[model samples]
Target chain A: MDIVLGQLFTGLSIGSILLLVALGLAIIYGSMGVINLAHGEFVMLGAYSTWLLQSAFGLPFLACLVLVFFMVAFAGWVVERGVVRFLYYRPLDTILATWGIGIILQQAVRLSAGAELRYVQTPEALAGSIDLLGIAIPSYRLFILAVTAGLLLLTWFLVQHTEFGMKLRAVTQNREMASCYGINSSRVFSLTFAFGSGLAGLAGALVAPIKSVAPDMGTNFVVDAFMVVVVGGVGSLLGTVASSGILGGSTAGLAFLLNDTLAKALVFLAVVVLIRFRPRGLFVDRVRR
Target chain B: MSRIKSPSHAWPPANSSAPPAAARPSLPQRASYVQILVYLAFCLLILAVPLVIDDAFLLNKYARYLALGLAAAALSLSWGYSGILNLGQGVSFGLGAYAIAMHLKLKTSPVHTGAAGLPDFMVWNNVQTLPWFWEPFHSTLFAILAGMLLPVIVASLLGWFMFRARIVGVYVAIITLAMLVVTNLLFIDQQRYTGGFNGLTDLAWLEIGGVEFDPYSPTFYYLTAGCLSVCLLLGLALTRSKAGLILRAIRNDVDRVRFFGYDVAAYQILAFAVSAGMAGVAGMLYAMVLEFASPTFMGVPLSLSMVIWAAVGGRGSLLGATIGAILVNFMQGSLSETFLDTWQLILGALFILVVLFLPNGLASLIDMAGERLGRAPPRARTEEPAAAAPRAMGTFNTKQRG
Candidate 1:
């Protein structure tokens, strides 16, 4: 029973991280209709940025998170203006271009930082473990869960309540209609892209302490993020959350029972089955052709 | 009816009135002449390079590139001709390599194994008896057959499900990528059977029918070159066949072809199987060239690199895809020596640039050059003759239809 609780908690934490990473992908894909393969690289960039800030400038972890978000967001904005803007309608070409961008980002980081893994110091306050009903859980893991929830709520509020979010949503729904109403669709696209990238950056920054920061680290996270976004269904935050929870909980539970490698294979197999059954995913939105 | 008929309703003015039979272009004849000349030159160069280049190492490297080129051409077959972008092409290649590598490992009979007639890694992993899977590989003929057949079988199975369900485009790419990841992980985890991360090594010279083929010798180079030539010719023949035409039509519009009562799924599966077979053969040669098989061969990066090769060479043309793989890999090799860090950066940028500006690739440039040199100034190189250029794939077709 204790083991089950521990596994459940671990699953929740893992799900939280997945949600954070996949949020940006869902948004970018939802609005821009661009499957950004380079989204993972943005996450890597965020992690690296946080590491640099914390190590070089001796900045607090929280301060680094804010800066990393802006920094990664700016990078995302540049990529959008330069490359992604041209291939909005060409879904296949956009995939290739973004994949190219991802390779460049990864290689650039490798060249600049060297191939060696780098570590980020976890905050001293969250270094210890907390006992809950006979289950010992790391405080940092709990903190990550809290941060992820807060960010999700914040994103929800922004999308639901803010005027800019309303404009972005309108543009995503129908560009011509939005433009007819005097909304600058291109600007909204760029801003939304930037915001999505910023969210990915925050996820990366938060994960840096748990996972070693490296140029190729994003490859692992990106696949998981894709699985989350894909299984959850595109264009729906609630679906993304639900799917991530299910996938994460199951994966953690499976890993506890089996080895890590076997658990991963099983998860992938499950995803394949899910995709086979629901090609459009769990919460597909109706659209006019 | 005759009384009601106006002068405008009479037979339309002869559209072909001015054209003389002698003056009119025989498009296929002219294009074939150029194609033949180009192929002859390529064949000649492949034969001549080893003789001209004093460095045996360079010759070996070139030979390896040709093997890789075969894999790229396979990608061209599936992606260019069939409009199926298989991102996990390396899975087939890796399977082929491992099959051959396993046999070679057994034949070499390297020392350090406690159990006689068993691979050193297996012995090290404390396997008391030979695994059932490795039994057939003891025979050289069986090993070679397995190398080619295994990947084809896997590809056909994968294609069966994917195409039958009408899963196309990015979904196919994602699924293939996932397969590659899974396969790589499996290869790494099964240490007892697969040699784990260290991979198969200490291979001896490949021998067939009492004849030994050494990796350093010119014979080995010729063997790979011969294999590549056969693959290219096969690819060319397939592209000219009736099935190829239908495949192209399907790529253009599956519904249209299906409406005509064609089994779209079967053709797709066939193309996929053939592509996998080509990749398998390439892998077999690759193992020979490198003298080992590693799990890295099944990696995502390698699979993507194959796509880049096909793209750069010109996915629209088979010969171009092969050449593209060779040229890009050669550039990578040479550039890495000079600018170690910047090579990948340059490659990434090149990939983006190619996708953005030169979607047709370096092959299209060659096509344009050849067209300019044609006796009759080519009819707008972009508007290639339908019979002369088999460039029918995906989104571009919609424009032609319009």
Candidate 2:
């Protein structure tokens, strides 16, 4: 019973990180239909930024998080304006172009960072573990869970309630209609892409303490993020949240049962089967224009 | 080239809404004199390479490049000609390589008095009896046959599942990518049989009818070049066929092709299978030249590199794709050796630039020149969406389900 609870908590924590990564992916893909294969690189940038800020400036982890978000968001914004904006309609081209961008980012980091794994120090306040119901949960993980939930709620409120969110949603659903109503669809795409990138950056910063920060670390996250987004369904935020939970929980549970490689294979196989049955994913939005 | 009748009588108009083919001007039937000259020049250059480079190691390296070029051309057949962007092509290639590697490994294993020979890795793992899967590979003919068949069979299954379910475009790319990842993991995990991360190595020289095809020998280079030439010609023949026209039509509009009474799924599967079979043959040639097979053969990076090769060479043309693979890989080899630290960055930047600006690839330049010099109006290449970017954005937003 104790072991199960501990694993569940671990799953939730991991799922929360996936949610952060997938939310940005879902939003960018939903709004622009540009599959950003460079998203994992955005996360990698965030982690590297966090490490740089912590080591160079001695900034607090929370402060570094905010800085990394903006930094990576700015980088994403540049990528959008310079490269992705030109390829928005060409989904396949966008994929290839962004993959190229990803390779560039990874190689750039490898060159500058000497291809060595870097670590970020967890905040002093959240360095220890706490006991709950006879199961010990690491304080950092609990902190991450709380932060993820807070970010999710904040994003929901922003997208669901704010005027900019309304514009973003309108443009995503009907670009022509939204443009007719004086909404700048291009701006919406740019902002949405930047916001999504910022979210990925935040996830990277949060995960830095636990996972080693390396040039290629983002590759793993991007694959998982893609699985989460695909299984969650495109153009659905709620689906992203729900699918992340299912995927993350199952991954943790299976990892505990089988080895890591087998567990990953099983999860991938399951996702493939799910996709075979439900091409649109677990949730199908019925919103009519 | 003249075997197929004039397009006006032999084929329907490409666009369903357009005027009947009989009313429009007839399409050109054969490559222009300039195009033929260019092809001959390329062939001559390839033939003259060994004479110019003399060093056996360098000759071997060029042979390896040509083998990869053949694999890249196979990718072009499916991705460029058929519009099925299969990202898991290395899965087929690697399977073929491993099939041949297994046969080589089994042959070199010291035969026991009472049992079939066991691979060293299997013996190391305390595997008592040779696994059932490895038994048939002991026969060279069976191993070679299996190498060609396995990739085609796997591609058929994958293509059937994807096309039948109407899962295509980016979805096909994602699914194929996932499939390759899964296969790589499986290969790595079954270390006892596959030799784990350190892939099968120390292969003996492949012997054919009492003659050794040693890697250092020119015979091996000739072997690769022969395979490459055959595969390239095969790809060219298919792309120029009436069936290739139908495949291009399917790419342009799947619904229209179905309306035209063609089974789009069948065409897609056929293209995919043929491409896989070619990749398999390339894999066998690669293993023979390199003397080993590794999980890296099916890795995501190599798979993506194949896509880049096709894209660079002008995915629209078979010869172009083959050239693109050779050029990029040759550059990669030389550049990486010269500047190991910055070569990947340069390659990545080059890829992005190619996709962004040179959408038609390096071949388009030749085509443009041919048009100017041949004094013929630019002929429309296959059904590729010429100016796909801006128009695509509009359609994407308009077609959004929500």
Candidate 3:
């Protein structure tokens, strides 16, 4: 029973991280229909930002997180304006272009930061584990969960209860109609792209302490995030959350049963099989036209 | 050239009152005379490499480049002509390499294999007997056949699942990329069977008809060159065939072709399988040249590099993709040697520039030059419809629930 509880806790921690990385991907892909391959790079940038801040400026982890979000968001905005804007009309080309951007970002990081792996210091406050009903969960894991939940709520509020959210929905549904009503669809897309990118950066910042920080580290994270988005169903926030939990839980469970590598391969096989059955994912958006 | 027919006929006439086939003007062939001449010239240039470059080391390096070029051409067949961008092409290439590497590993002398005659890694892992899967690879013929066939089988299965589900465009790319990651992990994890990260090294020279094809020999170079030429020619013929026309038509508008009662999935799977076979062959040749099959062969960077080759050379042109792969790889080799760390940065930037400005690749530039010289007719560029992008976006927003 203790083992089950521990595994469940581990699964939840994993799910939260998955959700953090995938939230931005889900938004950008759902809204703009642009497969931002460089999203992982943005996450990498966030991690690097956290490391740079802590080492260079001696900033706290929390402070680094706040600044990293905006800094990475700005980078995303530049990418959108500079390259992704032109390829919006060619959705497939956007994949290749964004991938190119990702390569550039990774190489740039490698050159600037040196190729060695960098580490971030976890906060003193969140260093130890907290016991809950005989289960000991790391405080950092709890912190990540809290941050993910808060961001989810924030994102939900932004999308559901704001004028920007309303404009975004209008633009997403019918660009011409939204434009007719004087909603600058392009600006909405740009902001959404930037916001989505910022979310990825935040995820990166949160993940820095747990995972090794390297230039190419984003590749695996991005792939995992993509699987979450794909399995969750594109454009559905509830679906993203649900799917991340399911995938995360299954990964934990499978890893427990088999070895880690086999577990990963099995999860991938499961996703592919699931995709075969449910092409649009587990949650279908009935509202989609 | 006379065998070339207008693929436009595969689609119904835009207007109900369109003229009969005979009454219509003769459509331009897929490749003009000048393009064919250029292809021949390119072939001649490759064949003459051994004569010009007497250095065995340089010759071996060129052989590897040509093998990569073949893989790029294979990619062009599916991505360029059929519009199925397989990002996991390296999976097939790696599989092919492993197949041949296994055979060579078995053939190696007892020095590498020890007394057990098992692969060095297996021995190291304390694996007493050869695994069942490794048994058939002992036959040179079986290895060569499996090198080509394994990727075909894998690709066909993957393509069947994907195309049958009506997964197109970027989704296919994502799925394939995911598969590449999965396959790479599997290959790396199964260190007992596979060589783990070190991969299969210390391979014996390929022996055919009692003739040893050493990596540095002119004979091996010719073998690689010969296989590449065959693949390119086969790819060219396929793109010019009736099915190829249907595949292109499907690429342009899948719904329209499906509406016309075509088996869209079948065509996609066929092209995908064939392309995988070519990539597999390329992988085998690559392993033969490099003398090892590492998990890195299936890495994302290598897979993406192949795409870049196709895109830079012109995915629309098989020969162009081959040239692109060769040129890019040669340049990468030289540039990395000269500038060291900055080659990847330059490659990434170049890839972005090509995708943005030269959508049709450097081959289109050649076409433009041909047009200017009055050597080729003005052909309508095979540009992706601008409406398709917005439509894809619109569908994502309002995708009908199944």
- Top candidate by TM-score: 3
> Per-residue lDDT tens digits of candidate 2, residues B1-402?
001011222223334322245643433434534454555576667766766676888887888888898888899899877777788889999999999998888777465212446676777777779879988987888888989999999999988988888777777777888888888888988888898887788676677778887777677777777777767766666776788988877766677778989988999999999999999998988887898999999888888888888888887777788899999889877764548668888888888888888765788767656555654433332222233322322232222121
Query: What tens digits encode model 2's per-residue C-alpha lDDT throughout A1-289?
Result: 9988989997898788889888889888866778788999999999999999999899989999889889998998989988998775456777788989999999999888768899999898899999999988899988988888888898889889999999988887767678889999888888888999999999899999999999988877887888898888877888999999999899899989986787788888888778777867898566553
List runs of model 3 lying over 4 Å from the truth: B1-33, B336-338, B378-402
Candidate 2: regions farther than 4 A off: B1-27, B32-48, B109-117, B336-338, B378-402
Please provide, for model 3 over B243-306, each residue's C-alpha lDDT reduced to its tens digit, 9 standing for 90 to 100.
9989977776687788999999999999999999999999999999999999999998899889
DockQ metric for all predictions: 0.28, 0.42, 0.47
**Interface RMSD score of candidate 1:** 13.1
lDDT of 1 at A24: 93
Q: Write the per-residue lDDT of candidate 3 for residues A172-253, one digit (tens) a residue.
A: 7766678889998889889999999999999999999999999999888888998898899877899999999998999999
Alpha carbon deviation, residue B266, candidate 2 (Å): 0.4
Tens-digit per-residue lDDT, B71-115, candidate 1:
999999998888888889999999999999998988885463446
- In candidate 1 the C-alpha lDDT for residue A159 amounts to 86
Ranking by TM-score: 3, 1, 2
TM-score of each: 0.92, 0.92, 0.93
